[model samples]
Target: MADIKVIIPAYNEVDSIAHVVNELPKSVSEVIVVNNNSSDNTVKNAETAGATVITELRKGYGYACLKGLEYIASKSKQPDIIVFIDGDYSDYPEELDNVVAPILEDDIDFVVGARRKNLREEGSMTPQQVFGNWLATFLMRLFFGAKFTDLGPFRAIKYDKLKELNMEDKTYGWTVEMQLKILKKKMTYTEVPVRYKRRIGISKVSGTVKGSIFAGIKILGWIFKYSIK
Candidate 1:
């Protein structure tokens, strides 16, 4: 069995973090929740729910994720796989088994849990978010002949393959950066359909006009920058 670890980047998700932690499959070896400077009960809740909680003073999604990676690196034994998921309870954490199945069963390098329209709850995704995913994925397909459809947060990858990507995005561009690098490296990857629902509280990114606009710019910037390279 592959030693699997999950990293959850939470920002003020106090209302939902515990549920997210409790629902993960038993196969997961560890659940690491990175509280991204949340001034709430997120840390307490996650710890109560049996997750190894860590704090990221920097308030970016990538910052929290990188913090988790650093913690894993400092451990005596490293996990064979790493899974990234949101702490908003929007994704079905129990489906973690499915998220990493491709990597375990087929020797795949990376797997993304695609939030398909049919499986997603009504209003789970905002219009801007929907359009952003479409535009970003379309650009990727046009530029690199890629088959990615959604920049979903629920995803998994092999530890060694993840290290090779040398991830550096510290904010809204993290997801796209990973996908772009996977394409650049010609790594084996696939997408698994996953159910999605409305998050418990307002989203830090898609719920605000400013956050949405900045996220779009960051995503596009990475795509265009990589296309030229």
Candidate 2:
């Protein structure tokens, strides 16, 4: 079995952080939750749930994720695979094994947990989120001949391949950046359908107008930026 590590970026998700931590499949060697300047009990709850909680004072999704990567890079024993999941408990953390299965069994370089509509609970994704996912993926298909369906947060990637991508997004462009780089490098990738449900608290991105606009702009910016390259 591959040594798998999970990274979860959380900001004021105290209501759902513990559930996300405890429900993770024991197959993962460690769960690291990067608390992105949360004012709630996120850190304490994540610790109680048996996750190695780290604080990232920076306030961006990518910043928190990069902090988790930094912590992993410092460890003497490196993981074989790294998985990124949200701390909102919207994704079924118990399905982690299924998410990483492609990478472990098929030797795929990267995997994204696709939140297929049929598998997703109604209202799990807001209108803007749905449209944005569609538009971004549509653009990817048109410009890059990519096959991605959803930009869902639950994902897994080979540690080495992840490092090779040289991820630098410090905000909403993180997911799209990874996908674009994978496509650019011609790396093998696949998506696994995963069940999804409404998040415990309101979303930091899709729940608000400002977040939605910024995220959309960032995602689209990454795609277009790569298209011209």
Candidate 3:
């Protein structure tokens, strides 16, 4: 079994997927890219980069992630750790080591790569993104008593424990769902600061006003839904 397997969920990210895949640490045994019905050449690019590609006809982030998990579960030798990263190249691929190191050392079951706001490129995030992150994280801390900053896509978690969470968010709530489930399970979790940069393409969420509002509602709703349970 591989020590670590990185899974990237991509939708129309042909421009950035190859770079993200190629830059990953060689220590990572395999790179899996979930092509979420992208119209572009995302799969071809990922394949060209020597990444294992899986096509998920679904059009949502959660769907892509679920498909990736299913692929991993069917592997002959399951990886000890699974890392989730965005295919847009917004996150620093080099920092993947930091996210998985804690798990390999048995320090935590989940590790979130929190983007250092000051280090992120200017305009890389919209106002709604900034406020949504702050508000949602604050609510989680107040209600669920979990500490987290930006719920960016870059994260790592143990494979077995992740399955126990039974994640089911189908949209932008994916990140919050994972975090809330881990907290509810009382699993060890930690956050490490990571660098963020501008993505090659525009974001699907937080790029427009309507998308941000909907995302915020879904995230907050999930937090409260899981907390009251």
Question: For model 2, what is the alpha-carbon lDDT of residue 70?
Answer: 98
* CA displacement after TM-score superposition, residue 37 of candidate 2 (Å): 0.4
lDDT of each: 0.97, 0.96, 0.90
**Candidate 1 per-residue lDDT over residues 136-173, each given as its tens digit:** 99999999999999999999999999999999999999
Per-residue lDDT for 1-229 in model 2, tens only? 7899999999999999999999998899999999999999999999999999999998999999999999999999999999999999899999999999998889999999999999999999999999999999999999999999999899999999999999999999999999999999999999999999999999999999999999999999999999999
Q: Model 1, poorest ten-residue lDDT window?
A: 56-65
Candidate 1 collision pairs = none
Ranking by lDDT: 1, 2, 3
TM-score of 3: 0.96
Worst 10 residues of 3 by lDDT: 98-107
Deviation of model 3 at 106, angstroms: 4.3
Off by over 4 Å in 2: none
RMSD for each of the candidates: 0.5, 0.6, 1.2
